[model samples]
Each structure stands twice: as C-alpha cells, then as structure tokens.
Target: MIKTLLFDFGDVFINLDKAATFRELKKLGLEDFSSGMMEQNQLYEMGKISSEEFVNFYISKIPESNSKKLIIAWNSILLDFPQHRLEFLQQLKEENKYQLILLSNTNDLHISWIKENVSFFTEFKSCFDAFYLSHEINFRKPNADIYEFVLEKHQLQPNEVLFIDDTQENTEAAKSLGIHTWNIDPNTEDVVDLFSTKSELF
Candidate 1:
C-alpha cells in the first residue's frame, strides 16, 4: 500500500552530465577538488554558504578563473528535461493515486539555471505535493536525518512511501529506515517505466 512517491530531481527528471563540471573545471586549471573543496561543495549544497562565497572559493583556488567562468563551469552538469517525463508526471498527478513529493540534493545555482532555462519548470514543480531541495532544507540525501525529516514532516509511514533515486547510497539509506526504494540506473532505466519496473509495488 504505497501512498506516497518520493522522487529525486537530477538524473531522474532532468538529464545531467555528471562529469561535465569536472571537465569544465579542468579547463579553468582546476585539476581536481581537494578534500576542503569537496567539503565546501557539501556546505554549498546544504545552503550553509552563499553562492557568492561558493564562487569566491573557486576564484581563490583558481586565480585565473573569474566568477562568471566558475559559475558556468559549475552549471555545465545540468542538461535537458525531457517532455515525456513531464507528461508522465502530469498524468500521475491527474490520477491522484499517491502523494508525490520531490526530494532533491540540489544547490542554488543549479536550480536558478533550471528556472531560467526549463520552460516547464513551474508546471513540473506544481505536480509535486511537497518539494524539498537540499539547499532550502539544509539536508542532503544519503543522510538519515534528511529522510527522517521528510517522513516526520509529512506524517508518512516509512512503509507507505516509495523513494526513487538514481544513487544507490540514497535509496539504501531510505530503505534502512523501512521505506521502499528503486535504485534506478539513469543509463538504462527511465523513470517513466516506474510501474513496469516495480510492478509488484504498484
């Protein structure tokens, strides 16, 4: 009796070139992110640091790179949002079978870019009953606290919510808390085939 559908944003709805950012950053003379930079990334994702601070950190590291170039390189990972996925979500919303909630590990810059570029971003957002972004909530996936926050906030039973994410670690974390999950592979699995792929649960 799944009463809720919890979804991830990137690699689930919108396409992403996961390696694009690193590739772009390499052009800016950043060969790799040090441990501190990785920590800063998580901090930025959780909204602990402002976007200005984020860009400044990169600029400080790569003196030759300007703010504009750093921002562009950071956003290079985001690609397209296919229309068919939106239609499938719209149909699901119309059916009103289960509560749809979007739980995404996203930062401010990425979201701002989507808002400006994705024409149907508003419509896509409207489909969800509750939308939770990592930066807004100060909680990112693969963290038990974030899952607990969502479950507690929604007053949902862990067993009744199906969490879908492209990352195995995220899905596994949810599953540990008694939630159902689909550890989808973006390379082969399309979210539009949810029912067919997880038929028994449906």
Candidate 2:
C-alpha cells in the first residue's frame, strides 16, 4: 500500500516557467549560461554556498547588474500558485490518508520571492508532514542520494511511496528505487484530479 506521497514543489504544486530564468538572464546581457554559472547554481541549491555569495557570483559576472537586478532575474521563473491546488491539498491533508511530503530543488532567492508573494504559503506548507528543500537538505533531485535520504529519514519503504514530479529525470530516478511515480505535465494536468487520474494507485 502507498502510505507516503512525495511531491515536487515547482510545476507540481506551484507554477514555474522553466525557461524564464534563461530569458531574463539574456536580457541582462548574459548571452551564454556558462558552466561556471551552472555549477554555482547547483552549489547554491545544495547549500554549499550562502545566498550572498550566490548573488555576488552573478554580480561579479555582470558588474553593471546589482544584487536586486540579479535577484529579480533569478526569481523570474516563479509564477502564480493556483487556489484550487491549495484547496485540493487541504482536503487531502484533512483526509489523513497519506503521509504527504514536499521535496523541491530550490534555492534561497526563489523561496524568498515565493514567501513574499504567495499569501497562503504557510498554510500550504502546513499540509505536508515534512518539507524538504534542496538548500536545507544539502541534496537535489535526479540524484539517487537525495531520494535515499528521504526514504531513510522517514523509515519509508520505496514501494510504499508515490513520487510525483514534473521532471522526467526526477521521476525516473525514484522509480529505479521501486517507488511509484507520476511524471505530471503541468500544461495539461491539474493535481486536483489525482484520484481520478491515478485511481488504480488509490
């Protein structure tokens, strides 16, 4: 029986424009996303570096761009959080049917933006039994260690967990460990129809 539900935050719960960051950076004259920049991002997501350092890294690259401009560009990917999804999550929490957990590969700047913009961020977070952010946990998705960390931390059997993510790479990694997965396409699907869509699992 699936007793635990592991969910990805972006694109699964909150809407995100995965391309918005690249586009925004281009506008800032960063025509190419260099390997160094990518490495810095992963480091930031893993909490290996502080937010000030992360912002400074970009600032050093584009000396004309200040911290505020870089932060706004970095946070351009986040979009609106739909009310219906929050309602759906609340109902699921009230039912107490599954041990809901949220796992996301996020950094400080993005989360800071969300906390400031999303009015019900706290309420939505309260629905989860555990909330694991990449920066806090020192791990990110598509990495086997991260998945193992969650399973071991919760003392959960891989077979008893249903991992839902918008990224195929993430879902596939979880599946390799015997967890059930749903690679949700946010454009065509709404998490509110979980029961109707994944009825067999329920």
Candidate 3:
C-alpha cells in the first residue's frame, strides 16, 4: 500500500515556463548554453556554489549583464502558483491519509522569487510533513542519492511511497528504486485529479 506521497514543486504545483529562461537569456545575447554553463547550473542547484558565485558566473560570461538583470533572466521560468492546487494540497494534508513530503529540484534564487511573489507559499509549505529543496539538501532529482536520502531520512519503504513528478526521468528513477510513480504531464494533468486518475493506488 502507498503510505507516503512525494511531490515535485515545479510544474506539479507552481506553474513554470520551461522555455522562458532560455528565451530570456537569448535576448541577453546568450545564443548558446554551453556544457560548462549547464554544469554550473547543476552545481548551483545542488548548493555547491553560493548565489554570488552563480551570478558572477553569468556576469563573467555576459559582461554587459548586471546582477539584477541576471537574476531576472534566471527567474523568468517561474510563474504563478495556482490556488486550486494549493486547495487540493491543503485538503490532502487535512485528511492525513498519507505521509506527505515535498521533494523539489530548486535553487535559492528561484525559491526566493517564489517566496516574494507567491503569497500562499508558506501556507502551501505547511501542508507537507517534510519539505526538501535540492539546493538546501545538496542533492537533485534523477540522482539516486537524493532518492535514497529521502527514503532513509523518512524511514520509508520504497514500495510504500508514491512519487509524483512532471519529469519522466525523475519518475523512472524513483520507479527503479521500487517506488510507485506518476509521471504527470503538467499541460494536461491536474494534481487535484489524483483520486480519480490513480484511484487504484489510493
């Protein structure tokens, strides 16, 4: 039986324009995102580097871009957190049907923007029994270590955990560890439909 639920923050809850950041960077003259740049992003997401260093890495690449502009461009992917999702999450929390845990691959800047812009962020956070952010935890999704960390930390059996994420790779990785997974398509799937869509699990 599924005794615990793990959720991804972006796309699953807060809406994101996955292409916005790339488009925004292109406007700032970043025509190509090099492998080095990608590595830096992963490092930043893992909290292996400071925010100052992250911004500086961009500034060093695009000398004309300032910290403020870089930050704005980086946060372009983030969008509003819909109220309906928040309500659904709150209802689940109140039901106390499962151990609700939030596992998100997020960085400091993105989270800071959400905290500043999403008015219900704190209330949404309160719905989860444990919240793990990639940067804060020094680990990220699609990585087995992070999944192992969550299972070990919560003392949960992998078979008893249900993980829901928008990314197929993430869900697949979790499934490999014996966890039940929902590789949801954010464009069509609404988390509120959990009961009807995955009724068998519940």
Candidate 4:
C-alpha cells in the first residue's frame, strides 16, 4: 500500500531549462564546463561542492565580464512556479490520502530566488510531512544512500511511497529500493493529471 508520496521539486514543479542555461554559459565563454560540467554538477547535487565553490569554479575559467554575464545567464533559468501545481498539491493535502514528503536536489541561490519570488513556497511546502533538500541534508538523489535515508527516516516501506521526479536516473535509483515512481515530464504530464489517473493505480 502506498502510504506516502515523495516528490522531486525541480522540473517536476518548476521549469528547468538546463540545456538553454549551459548554452548561454558557453556563449559567454565559460568553456571548462562545456564538456564535463555535469560531473561537477553531480557533486553539487551530492553536496560535495559548495554553491560558492560551484559558481567560483565556473567563473574561474571565464573572463571577468563574461564570468559575471555567465552567472546572470545561468541563474536566470529559475522561472516562476505557477500556482496551479501548488493548488493541486494543496488539494491532495486536503484529501489526506497519503503522507506527502518532498525530496529535492537544490542550492542556496535557487532557494534564495524562490523565497524572493514564489510567495506560496511556505504554504505549498507546509503540505509535506517532511521537505528534504540536498544542500540542507548534505545528500542528493541518484545515490542509494539518500533514498535509504528517506525511507528509514520516515519509517516508510519502499512500497508505501511513490517517488515523482523528472529525472529518469533519479527515479531508477528510488525504484532500486522498491519505491514506486513517476518520471513527470511537465511538457507532457501535469501533476493534476496524476491524481485522477492514479486513483486506481496502486
């Protein structure tokens, strides 16, 4: 029985233009990251790298002006999170169907931007029994440990939780531990669509 719902916050809720962000950075001369940056990015997601270190590492490779421009361009991908998603989550909270927990890989800058722009963040997050973030927990997805941490922390059996994320590899990691999962593609799948479709799912 699925008693809990574990959600990933990035592309599942907020739109992420990763490809566009990297392209913008390259245009501004942040070259080193052009090839192997995701490897370093995995470190960030794993909390192996500090936000400052992550930014500085990239900035170190670019000219001063281009570095500043790259930072602006990179950070600009964080767009608005619409209220409809929040409303959907809120409705689920009202239904009291499952214990909601959110697990996300995020950083200080992305968070700071949300606090400044997404006013419903607090309310939306309140719906969750636990809200886990990589930077806050010093752990991340695609690592078996993080999945284990959540499962054990919540005393949740893998079959009792459904993990929703936009990343395939991350979902696979959760599935390895027996958790149910959904790889939400915002372009194709709306979270609201899940509630109806998943009624008889489990």
How are the candidates ranked when ordered by TM-score, highest leading? 1, 3, 2, 4
Q: Which stretches of candidate 2 lie over 4 Å from their true place?
A: none
| Candidate 4 lDDT (Cα, 0 to 1) | 0.81
Across 90-194, the per-residue lDDT of candidate 1 in tens digits comes to 999999999999999999999999999999999999999999999999999899999999999999999999999999999999999999999999999999999
lDDT of 4 by residue, 1-202 (tens): 7889899988777777767776777677656454457777777766778777877777766655444565567677787687898988999899998999999988766777777878888998899989998888878888899999998898888988888998999999998889888888878887777766566656
**Model 2 TM-score relative to the real fold:** 0.98
CA lDDT, candidate 2, residue 10? 97
Maximum-TM-score candidate: 1
- For model 1, the superposed segments whose C-alpha errors exceed 4 Å read none
Estimate the TM-score of every prediction. Answer: 0.99, 0.98, 0.99, 0.90
- Which candidate, 2 or 4, has the higher TM-score? 2
Judge candidate 1 at residue 144 and give its lDDT.
99
Candidates 1 and 2, the one with greater TM-score: 1
- The CA lDDT of each predicted structure is 0.97, 0.93, 0.95, 0.81
lDDT of 3: 0.95
The collision pairs in model 3 are none
lDDT of 3 by residue, 4-100 (tens): 9999999999999999998988888788899999999999999999999999999899888899999999999999888999999999999899999
Better of 3 and 4 by TM-score: 3
